[model samples]
Target: MDVDFGGADDILFERSGHAGIVTLNRPAALNAVNHRMVRALTRALAAWEADAAVRLVVIRAEGRAFSAGGDILDIYEAGRAGDPPFDFFADEYRLNAAIARFPKPYVALINGIVMGGGVGVSFHGSHRVMTGNAVFAMPEVGIGFFPDVGGSHFLSRLPGGFGLYLALTGNRIRHGDACAFGLATHSVPADDLPALLRRLCETGDADASLAVDARAVAAETEDAVMDAIARHFAHDTLDGVLGSLAADGGEWANAMHATLMARSPTSLRVTFRQIRTGATLTMDDCMRMEFRILSRMLVGHDFYEGIRAAIIDKKSTPHWRPAALDAVAQADVDAYFAPPAGGDLSLQ
Candidate 1:
C-alpha cells in the first residue's frame, strides 16, 4: 500500500506494508539536502512514529551519491546576502536528534556516498546498511565547518581516537572500513539492496531480513593504524597534536601535517574541542553544542571564505583568516561553544 504524503519533489514519502519509506530523488544534485527536504523528513518520521501501520522506517537515495551534504550553496548565498540561515541548521539538527531517538527500527540503505548531513540521518539509526560502493566521511573541516549533524556525539564515541583523526583530516572511508569501525551495521551488495528493502518492508523484521544478505565485516589488518591515530590525536590541545606530528617527521605524519595546514585553522581547533567535549555529553546535548558552533560559524569570516574558494570560485585556494593554527586564540575557540542569541537547541 502507498501513502500519499505531499513533500518536495526531490524527496518521496510513501508507505509500503509495515515500512515507511523516504527516497531521496534528486540525482542530478546528488541528493543534497535542503531545508524543505529536512522539514519533510522530520514530518514523515513523526507521522510514522504515531501510525501503528508503519512498524519500521527505511531511508534510501535514488542517486549515485546518497547525499553529498546539505545545500551549502544555499547557505553561502544566504550568508552573502546578510541572512545567516540559522533556521536550516535548527531544523536539520532537530531532525538528526529525532532520528537518534526514533523508537522504531530506522534503517538507512546506503549504496553510494554518505557524508556530512547524510551521515546524520543514517548513522544515528538502529540499522545502517551499506553496500560495497558506499563511502563515508565528514569533510566539514575543509569548508571551515565543524562536522555537525550529531557528529560531536558519534565521532566522539568511535574507538581509538579514529573520530578526531577523521575530523581533522576529512578522510573518506569505504564500506569495509566503516563496518570495521562500527559506523556501518551491516554489509550488503548494492545489487541486493532492493531485495533486502523489499524483505524489510514486507516483514518489518530488520534482524531477520538483514541477516539474509548481510555479513560481518572482517577487521582489516591495515586498521592497526588506529593505534597511530590514537597516539598522534589523543593530545589535549591542537598544538599538542601538531607538535606530536611534527616531532615524528615521518611520511604519514608529514602528510597529515600538510593536510591540516591546507584546512581552515579555525575549523581544525573548533572540531578538536567539539569532539572532546562531546565525549562527556549525551546525543541531545551534543546537538545543542553543535548548534552553538553553527551560530558562530555562520557569522564568522572563514566559512564564507571557504565556500568562495572551494565552491563558488573553484580555486581551492582559501586564504583563511588567521592563517596559522597558533593564531586561533583559545578564547575565540571557546566562543564557538557558547550559547547563541537564540539560546541552545531545545530538543524536547
Candidate 2:
C-alpha cells in the first residue's frame, strides 16, 4: 500500500495496478467521516487524479457500517463551546462536489449502514455497489438538518415524489429497495464482494465487474406505492401532505404522519423547499443552496437541541422551536434561503 499526502492513515489510499483504493479506517467509530478524514480524502482524490497509473477508484469502509455520518458529536461539542460549524460544512460539501465531478470512474462499496454524509460519497460515484448488509437512509431531518451534500439534486430526481417523503420522514431502505430507488447500481451479496473487488482491481474498469454474475439493481417501481407517494408527497406544501396523510386511513399513511410530526417543524419546512426548489437546479446549484441553509441552521436553536436529544442524551425527543408545524411560516423558511454569510459555495 502506498501512503501519501501528509501520511494521515485514517483514510488510507493505495495503488494496485490501475486502480486506486480508499479504505475508511475508523471501525470503532462506525467509520464516521470527520474533517480530518475529509482532508485526507481530498488529498487522495487530487493525487490519484494526477497519477498516470490510476484508472479507477474504489472507496470502502472497514467496519460494520460503511459510515455513520459526519462527526455530529464534534458539531455538538462545537455548539456547546460556542464555535461555528462553518469550516466543517465548507470542506464536506467541497468533497461532495469533488466526488460528483471526478473524471475517472468511481466505485463505492455500500456494505452496511449508509446514511447522511455516506450518501454524498457513494451516491455521487459512477458505480454504487450495495451488498445484502446495505441499509440506506437520509435521516438529517431527524437531526434538525435538511439532507445536504447534493441531496436536493439527487432526491428531487427520484421518481414519484418519493424524495420528498424520504427527506421528511428519514425512512430506511434496504439494498434491493435502494436499487429500485436509484440509490444503488448493483446488488452483489456480501459473500461475493471480495471476488468482485478483485475483478474490479484486476481489470481496472467497472464494466469488467459488471459483466460478472451479479444482480443488477434495476430501477423498477410499484404502481401502488408510487400512487400513494404521489397522493401524499406530490403536493408542494408540507401541510398538504400532512392533510393527505390524516385523511387516509392506511397504516402507511398513519406511520408517515407520526414520523413527520416528530421531525423539526422548521427543518421540515426548509427541507420541503430544499428538495422542491432544488429539483430544478443543477447539482452545483443544489450544493450552493444547501450551504445557505446550513449556515442558517448552525446558529439556530433546533440543531444543537436535536443533537443533544438524539446523540448526547439519548432521549430521542427533540422539542423543536416551532412546536407546531403550522407555526413555521413561509417567511421563516425563506430566511434560510437568503445568501449565506460567506457567500455561495464555489466548486472551483
Candidate 3:
C-alpha cells in the first residue's frame, strides 16, 4: 500500500469537521502533479471514501494557480535519463476516475490557472466552483497529445459544440464562461474563497457554502462569433473542420484556421476521433482509450519534440512529424487506440 500518506504531503490532506480537505501545496511548481502527489491523492481519496464521518471532500490549492497540469518537466527528464514515465498517468487517471464516482459531495474551489491534469481532478468533482481568478484550458494538442483526463467524455457533451471548439483551439475558458459552458456549477469571487472554505468545512455542505449574490458569474457564448464556430467545428472530422474554415473568408475563421494549422497534425486527428468516439462511451471507457493513446505517444516522435519546444528549450515551436493535417493517415491515428504496452489501466 502506498498509504504512507503522512510521509507525502505535496498533496496535503486533513479532516475538518465532517469534511475531508486536500490541498495541492507545491506553489512554486504551481502544484503541477508529480507521481508521488498522484499516489498521495489516490490514497487519501480512497481513505475518505471508506470513512463514514466525511460527508464531503474539498479540493483546493495554495498558490497563484490551482495547477498547471501534470509535471511536464518530469516526463521530459525521464525520457532524457532513459526512464519510462508510465506510473504518473496510470495513477492520475485512477484518481480522476475516483473523483468522478465519489459518492459524497466533492467540492472544488478552482481559483487560478486550471488546465490539463488540473481539469482531470477538479472537473470530475460534484461541484466545481470557479472563482474570479479562475482560468481553464485543455492545451494537449499543442504538445502532440490529445485531451485526456476524461475530457473526451465530458467535453464532447458541452452545449453547442463549444467543447469541440475548445479541444481544437486550446482557447482559455474564463470567469462566467466557465458557468456558461457548464464547466462550473457555481461562481464565487476570489476574495471570498477563504470564508467559503470555512463555511464548507463547518457545515460539510456545498450549497450552504456557496451563494450567487456577490459571486454571480454571467457569460455569453452565444454571439455572432459562436455562429461561425458552430458552422466550422460541428464537423465530425478534423479534415472537414479544416475544409470549412479554409473556405470561409471571415477574419475570425482565418485566425482559427491558422490556429488549427499550428497544432500537431497527429494530435488533432486523433483528438477529433477521440472526442466523437468518447461521446458514446463511459468515463472509464474514455480513460482507457486515453491510456492507450498516451502510451503510444510516449514512444512517438512528436511527444518528445513537443516537450523540447514547449518546456525544455522554451522555443514554443514543435516540428510535428506529420506536419500537416492532410499528411496523417487513418492507420496512423488508429494505431493510437491499440492496446497499451503496459496493458489497460488497473483501476481496481
| Each candidate's clash count | 0, 0, 0
Better of 1 and 3 by lDDT: 1
Stretches of candidate 3 exceeding 4 Å from the true structure: 1-7, 212-214, 220-222
Ranking by lDDT: 1, 2, 3
Look at candidate 2 and tell me the lDDT of residue 40: 81
Q: Estimate the overall C-alpha local distance difference test score of candidate 1.
A: 0.90
Reference-based TM-score, model 2: 0.96
The alpha-carbon RMSD values of the candidates against the true structure, listed in the order shown, are: 1.3, 1.7, 2.3
Lowest lDDT 10-residue stretch of candidate 1? 216-225
Candidate with more favorable, higher TM-score: 1 or 3: 1
- In the range 149-255, model 1's lDDT, one tens digit per residue, is 99999888888778899899999888887888788999999999989989998999999999899976765537546677889998888889999988988888899
What lDDT does candidate 2 reach at residue 86?
88
Local distance difference test, candidate 2: 0.86
Ten-residue region with minimum lDDT total, candidate 3 = 1-10
Q: List the residue pairs that clash in candidate 2.
A: none
Q: Residue 166's C-alpha lDDT in candidate 2? A: 82
